[model samples]
Target: MSRILIVDDEPHLRLLYETELRRAGFETMTASNAVQGLEFVETMEPDLVILDIRMAGMDGIEAMQHIMERDQRVPVILNTAFSSYKDNYLTWAADAYLTKSSDVTELVETVKQVLEKQATAHG
Candidate 1:
């Protein structure tokens, strides 16, 4: 099973993602903020990370820089509600970018597809 790290400021968002990803057959870990997310990644070394860009402390972009430094192969999916910042967000390196309102089916399919691509590239 593929392991995934989900990071969001909202506890409910993490819970929703955890449940949905679990149903999709992925082992999931949840973190309420980027700091915890980074620590979890250090220990678990998940195959992918789904992150929210508007965190309070260390935002997703900053945290992602650290994550990439440690594990460049670990794909990241950046989700943001602010559509206006799309250009700014794209400057950050991410394997994928998803809007927070994206359909659940699309989210699931995208994650799976990214995981498959990551597997192939690393294999």
Candidate 2:
């Protein structure tokens, strides 16, 4: 099973994503902020990351830069409540980008697609 690290400031989102991803047969980990998420990226070495653009301390864009520097191979999915971030060029570094919604079906599908694409690229 693929391990996914979900980085978001919202506690509810973290739990929601974790529950849904687990149901999708994935191993999930949650980090409340970009700082913790970065640590998980280095220590846990998750197969994929679902990152939120806006957080308390370091934003996801900066965090994504650090994550890529540490390991470019790990794919990141930018999940944000604000669609405006998509216009920013920095977000392009992520493997996938999606606006947040109450329904998690899109999130789950995107996760599978990103993971599959990463697997293909690595192989």
Candidate 3:
């Protein structure tokens, strides 16, 4: 099964995402903050990561950078509540970026697109 790691500081966000991804037939994992996220990347070995850009300590950009260093091929999708952050996401190695207000269907589609595209390239 395809695996996904969701990193969000908001408890509800994590739960909602986890539930949604699970219902979509993806094996899901969660990390509440970037610190915990790094650990999950090392241990959970998720095929894709849905990361929140605005976090307490290590933001999504920094987390994406670190994750890239560990596994350059894995796709990391960055999401943020603030529109301003969208402009700066290109500098990071994140595979994709979308606003939090984006519809759940869009989010799911984006994730599938990214992973399928990556898998095609990798395979």
**Top candidate (TM-score):** 2
The residue ranges of model 1 lying beyond 4 angstroms of the native Cα positions read 89-92
lDDT of 3 by residue, 7-70 (tens): 9999988988888888889999999999999898888788999999889998888888888887
Output the lDDT of residue 28, model 3: 94
The C-alpha stretches of model 2 lying farther than 4 A from their native spots are none
- Is 1 or 3 the stronger prediction by TM-score? 3
**Cα error of candidate 3 at position 47, Å:** 0.4
Clashes of 1: 0
Select the stronger candidate by TM-score from 2 and 3.
2
Per-residue lDDT value at 2 in model 2? 97
Q: On residues 91-114, what C-alpha lDDT tens digit does candidate 2 reach at each position?
A: 998999999999999999999999
Report lDDT (CA) for all predictions: 0.85, 0.93, 0.85
Instruction: Give one digit per residue, the lDDT tens place, for model 1 in 1-123.
Output: 999999999888788888888999999998999999999988889989998989999998888888888835578888877765578854358888888863567677889999989888879
What value of lDDT does candidate 1 attain over all alpha carbons?
A: 0.85
Ranking by lDDT: 2, 3, 1
C-alpha RMSD between model 2 and the true structure: 0.9
Candidate 3 regions with alpha-carbon error over 4 angstroms: 89-92
